[model samples]
Target: MPVRHRWSAAAFCAFALLALAACGTLNTVSGIFGNQINFTAPQLQRYLNNSFPREFDKLGGLVSATLTNPKLTIPPGDNRLRLDFDVGVRAVGAGEVSRGRFALASSLRYDPATRGLHLQNPEIVSMEVPGSGSLIKGGTRELLNAVLAEYAREEPVYRIDSDLLARLPSGKRIGSTDIENGLVVVHLDR
Candidate 1:
């Protein structure tokens, strides 16, 4: 081989080795950083405000319901999320309609397998249906839970997208979730 070609080949090999070493160092450094993500209440509120209406509108069978003005709050003690919204419900064929405000409190669970935050054990905290009294309130609660269960089965309240998960080092996964000080803190671990 020519001297110039030999020198060029040697330099290319050295550059490749250096590039590989840098990549390895980056991975090592990222692993040591211990990634954790904090999702604030305002962010979650925006997501729910945007998604709840679209999801609720899809349940258009016996009862047609519309959710508007969704308000999210984190209650003290339990790490559950409280969602208050204005609901309008119309029953098909029965000619009965109700418009009122309702609140639902649900416990949050983190599913590592899917990298999503799921709402579980949702309970109707309060419901006001004019003229129908407690009977309609009870029925509304049951209907809401049923509908929410179906929705939750298919979609999580919040999912950590694959792109975000890819940023974490291999083997590092979401560990735990805590709701405090109006924030959802997600821990990541290997």
Candidate 2:
């Protein structure tokens, strides 16, 4: 065999082996990483605590409200997410402003069409209006519920960004979402 031909064959074999090794490395890395991503409860809680107040303030209406000092928790063995915060509300026409604290519990659901997570069926479990008489407090609670109901129908408490899911491996999509032991587990299609 000619020396030149032998050199060309050796180079070709080397290139082929390198290409195969690269493919193997890629497969190994993907396998190690798995097909799922998890957002722990504390991490989400921090994100909400920082951003939710600004988002809440965007809802301007008859009873405009701002949520402050927000705290989020997921109860053990429960699939729901709970948020507690101090809320300041102002009536549009009445010129009445009040401060209070409230807690909301919501179930988590993944919307396949949107490729996002949503807080569904939010319920105001508790509310307190400081310095208000019983009658006034009752009226305030009713009014808050009405306002919340309207908002609930229109928006979710929080939504995971679609762009986040877009970065996943091709053909990978959110398969399921569950809250377990204060963590939000998002399973992805392999």
Candidate 3:
């Protein structure tokens, strides 16, 4: 083989090795410096379960009940309570990444009688970890939990038409009535 060809081959091999080395470092960089590894649903759920209920109990008047209307078309479960929730997640800024907040506003069909809908909130909760990445999987769980806990109960999160509330056998009192002096009970335990 020509000397120039040998040099060229050597240069190509060096570039290939460098490219492989760069690729190999990606997982390690993700491990050490990216938010891709921190989004664990189970872990977040456990944290929320422990942290949120106490906050709820402290914030009086929001009754945690469940849906009992046999004629109503809604998600299954005795804990399907109607409630209003506001969720916010703030990402702590680090390095070149700018910090930001994710917020969600929604009125839920919560059953103050069964408290089933509380489960729905956490299902909507999302978070951004510094290196592990955003916790899109069931981040809503914590977000819902947090929002429900902090919700101001005097006003209905969303207006339930009196007629609709009246349709449920246990309606009006649990549905249209103000949760201000009402109680909010969380049925889903971690």
User: What's the lDDT for all of these models?
Assistant: 0.71, 0.67, 0.32
Best by TM-score: 1
Model 3: worst 10 consecutive residues (lDDT sum): 30-39
Record all residue pairs in model 1 with backbone atoms less than 3 Å apart, i.e. clashing.
none
For each of the candidates, the C-alpha root-mean-square deviation to the true structure, in angstroms, is 10.4, 10.0, 22.0
Output the worst ten-in-a-row residue range by lDDT, candidate 2. 24-33
Candidate 3 per-residue C-alpha lDDT over 1-190 given as tens digits, one digit per residue, 9 for 90 to 100: 8999999999999999999999876532312112112111222233334433222221242322111111111123322322222222332332222122233323234555432222333232223323334453244344335544455332223332345333433311332211111122211211
Instruction: State, as a TM-score between 0 and 1, how close model 3 is to the true structure.
Output: 0.21
Candidate 2 Cα misplacement greater than 4 A, ranges:
1-35, 54-60, 111-116, 146-164
Q: Least lDDT summed over 10 consecutive residues: which range in candidate 1?
A: 25-34
Q: Could you tell me how far off, in angstroms, the CA of residue 182 lies in candidate 3 after the best superposition?
A: 22
**Per-residue accuracy of model 1 over 59-139 as CA lDDT, tens digit each:** 457776677788888876657788788887778786546788888888667887656787777777888777776777777
Give candidate 3's error at residue 97 in angstroms. Answer: 9.4
